[model samples]
Every structure is written in C-alpha cells, then in structure tokens.
Target: MSKHAGVVLPNKFDYGYHAEFQRQCSMCIDDATIEGIVFDFSRVEYLDSAALGMMLMWQRRAAAANKKMMIKGAKGATAQILAMANMQRIFEYI
Candidate 1:
C-alpha cells in the first residue's frame, strides 16, 4: 500500500506554527510507511515568507527521507504566493 499523509495547514501559517509544523513534519518523516505527504493549504488565510521557508524545509526533509511531497487545495492568495515562490517546480500539486 502506498501510505501518504495530509498535513492540514492552520489559518495563520506563520512563525507561530513552527513547533506544530516541526512536529508534523517529524511525524511524517519518522514513519517509514509514509511514502508521501501532501500539505493541505485550503484553510490557510494568512502566511508570510516564514511559511514559505517552512515549506522549503519540509520539502528538503521529505527529499532526504526519499519521500514525495505535494501541495493541495492552494487557492487565492495562497496559490499565488506558492506560484510566486516557484513551489510548483518542486512540489507536485494534488
């Protein structure tokens, strides 16, 4: 079975979510059964460059673990921001 994790992003994907984000990323990375992770951005309302940096970190971690990474439900400003950061080139959109 192909195991995957969907990490639901919070409303304010800022520095405040650092701990939680790290925990989530670690959870996924530590799980050897998890073959991929999809960052769900449907509920995110506000985000900053910090959030972008976090995403990059997650991507790197996932790569190092030999796992796939993806984005889901990124709309409005969230979508625009990801596009501006060229996240599409790194993460698959689901």
Candidate 2:
C-alpha cells in the first residue's frame, strides 16, 4: 500500500456522504503503511456543518493513529468556510 492515501470529496459533502467517507477513512487509517491522509476538496463546491463535524472526528482519529492530516484544493466558498471554522489549525493545506 502507498504511504499516502487520500479521498477525493464529492461536490455536496454532507451527512449523506458519511458512510462512504468512513469506508474510505477506514482503509486509509487502518493501513500501517500510510503516514498521511489527504482530504481533497477540489471538486467540492459545497459542504455543510455536518461535513465539518465529520472532518473533526477524522482528524482526532488520525492524530490518535499518529497520522498526519491534510486538506487539498480548498478554494472559494469552501476555503472561506474552512477558515471561519479554523480547520487550518488541525489540517495542513496542500
């Protein structure tokens, strides 16, 4: 398995996407070889508070596993929302 794993987020990231996100997160987090996980928001045009909550949960899990967390391609409204939520403190933007 690769050292780095990532999930390309969908356009509408909300509660409905939780299962899929959890599935992918398990694959990445369970892999011992993985040192980092990236959340690619390039294609995500909108995200609700639920999505933010999910990300926070995952960030805590990742840290507990000694894995780094990164956020990629966040721009426009997505970027603004994240900034307002202060997500940058926990996730490195790549």
Candidate 3:
C-alpha cells in the first residue's frame, strides 16, 4: 500500500497529470493496496470550477474503486469555497 499527499494546482493539474494520478489511484484501489490520498490545501490559493469538477469526478472514481480521498490543511478562503460548494460531503475533510 502507498499513500500520496499534496496540493495540485490547476497549472500542474493538467489532464495528463490528472489521468496519471487517476491511474495510480485506480491501481491502488483495485488491489486494495493503497492506503489513501490526502490532499493538502495549505498552498491552494485559487481553484476554478473545472478544478472543483475534477475533484468531484475523482471522488466518484475513488468511491467506485472502493478507495478513500481526503482533503486537509485547508484554511481561509479555500475552506470557505469548499464549504460553499458543499465539497465536504464529496471529499472527506480532515
């Protein structure tokens, strides 16, 4: 089992990288070998609707694969945005 933790910005969260991340997560889930994913929002200053959509998509994927996705270290406006969007229900907030 493996664990990955970090904040992915839109610029770095391009389709290619996102796909790769998904693939990794899928593999982990399939094998029941991955512990989980922890997304740290300490440095995330901005997030577009697309990013939010991507997160929701990922949440679904994780659920289908029987894996867990968690968000942590969010503060300030970032936390507010997530709350406003009701992302807390989609992604486990820590």
Candidate 4:
C-alpha cells in the first residue's frame, strides 16, 4: 500500500504557476473527504516565495477541512528551502 495521498503537486513550483497549484489544492481541500494530504517533493528541484505562499495556503485549507498534511522526499535545495522557511516545525516531514 502507498502512504501518499491523492492530492498531487507539481515537480516545480514558483510564482508563475501558483494559480494552477492553488487550484489543485483547493480541489482536495474543498472536497473535504480526504484522510490526509501529502506533498511529494522528490522531483521538486526549485521553489520560490510564491511556493511558500502556496504551501501556506494549502496548510490553511487543509486545516479548515480537518485534514492532516505531510511532506516527504524533499532533498538537496528543496530540503534547504523547507528548512529556511522553518516549515519543518509546522509540517510533518517524513
């Protein structure tokens, strides 16, 4: 069995694509029927300020829907970005 959730994010996230990413997250959150949301960062090589905002927005949306959120497979610069944002404290990283 897979631990990953159905909510999927893109391999690369930044300001230019924030709207699309937001839409995907909204679908998961507004559905309000998912057990959890997992952001698989294995392919995410770069992210930006908008990416941070997008994550925060998703976090809020998930909270509103009473869904747990998780992050996994963040490596290299992706890991550093998460650390720099201090997201490790707020999100469950596995």
> What is the lDDT of every predicted structure here?
0.93, 0.94, 0.67, 0.77
Candidate 1 lDDT at 86 equals 94
Q: Which 10 residues in a row give candidate 2 its minimum summed lDDT?
A: 1-10
| Candidate 3 segments exceeding 4 Å error | 1-31
lDDT of 2 by residue, 48-69 (tens): 9999999999989999999988
Error of 3 at 56 (Å): 0.5
Candidate 3 TM-score, true structure as reference: 0.70
Per-candidate TM equals 0.96, 0.96, 0.70, 0.84
Local accuracy of candidate 3 as per-residue lDDT tens digits, 1-94: 4565444443333354566657655555566556566666776766666667777887787777766788887777778888999988778877
All candidates: CA RMSD (Å): 0.7, 1.6, 3.5, 2.4
Worst 10 residues of 4 by lDDT: 1-10
For model 1, which pairs clash? none
Query: What residue runs in model 1 are displaced by over 4 Å at the alpha carbon?
Result: none
What is the TM-score ranking, best to worst? 1, 2, 4, 3
TM-score of model 2 relative to the true fold?
A: 0.96
